[model samples]
Target: MKIGELVKQYGVSVDTIRFYEKQQLLSPSARSDAGYRLYSNADSQRLGFILRAKSVGFSLQQIRELLLIEDNKAAWQCADVKDKVQLKMQDIRQQIAELEQFYQALAKLDQACCGGALSATECSILTALEQGKPAQPETHQEDASC
Candidate 1:
């Protein structure tokens, strides 16, 4: 298929497909007489996998490792894949904890604000920011929804 067909089929921009080619993630299987790139069904499948991996926050390097494993499955172990997923999960959990801390701090600062007819210099949130106040500790009483 032509590059235009691929872009329309995948709902991605031409530049995105070109970038994948430049990154060595995807390659044209052949070129037409007019010098247009030609792709195969297998290439389309690989592009789909690349898009899915990116959607889940996989870096291009990580996606490359996955593609390598896909190309040579007999030489790779499932344990290696599991290890990478574990590391990603750990990073996500740490990020969530940090975000929760930030949320608490922002909430405290917002509550402290009087919202009166005061200038920015007199704002409590601004004063707290100027003083470099630390984030508040999380209260860990479990909620049913959580």
Candidate 2:
């Protein structure tokens, strides 16, 4: 099939497929007499894999590494693939933890303010920010009203 066919079938832009080709993530199986790129079923499957990996947050580099392992599956152990997934999971967990901390800090700052129609100069939230007061949850009192 031609590149246009892939675009229609995959619901991705032509540029996206071209970029993947440029990145060595996807390639045409052959070129037509008129110089159009021709892809095989295997190429379509590879594109599907690339899209699925991206949907799950895999970087292009990570997808490339995964494709390398997949291409040489006989030479690799299942543990190798599992290890990569585990590392990604750990990274996501760390990001979640950091986000949770930020949420707690913001919640503290939010609770410190009454969300009233007070002037900006009298706003507790703005005051905390201007004073460089840290929004550490432990240091903030939930009962404190603006």
Candidate 3:
């Protein structure tokens, strides 16, 4: 198959495929007698895995590691893939904890705006922001729903 058809099949673009090739993520394929690059079904599968790995927030380095395991079938035949995935899951959990903290802080600030002067300087929004702390607030999820 040609590069263009591979893009259609994988829902990516020619530039993306070319970039992957340049990154050494995709191996160079055979060229036709006319010198056009010809891809095989394996190329399509590799591109698909790259796309899926990216969708789940795997970095290029991580994807490369996965590809190495995939190619060898031994890197993961034991417990290496499981360990790597466990580390990624731990990182994701830490990020979620930080995000929840941010969400709570923002939700807390919304309470100050409920009853305060309407002017910008006197505005609870501006005052809280300038002070970098809430002046006695209650956190609620509904406050941020809007």
TM for every model, in the order presented, reads: 0.84, 0.81, 0.77
Best by lDDT: 2
TM-score leaderboard ranking: 1, 2, 3
The collision pairs in model 1 are none
Give me the candidate number with maximum TM-score: 1
Error of 2 at 9 (Å): 2.2
Question: Can you give the lDDT of residue 18 in candidate 1?
Answer: 98
**Considering TM-score, which of the candidate structures 2 and 3 is the better prediction for this target?**
2
Backbone clash tally (model 2): 0
Cα deviation at 22, candidate 1, in Å, is 1.9
lDDT of 3 at 43: 82
Ranking of models by lDDT: 2, 1, 3
Specify the poorest-scoring 10-residue window by lDDT in model 3.
Answer: 137-146
Which segments of candidate 3 are over 4 A away from where they belong? 33-35, 115-119, 135-146
Task: For candidate 3, give the lDDT of residue 129.
Answer: 78
Cα lDDT of candidate 1 equals: 0.84
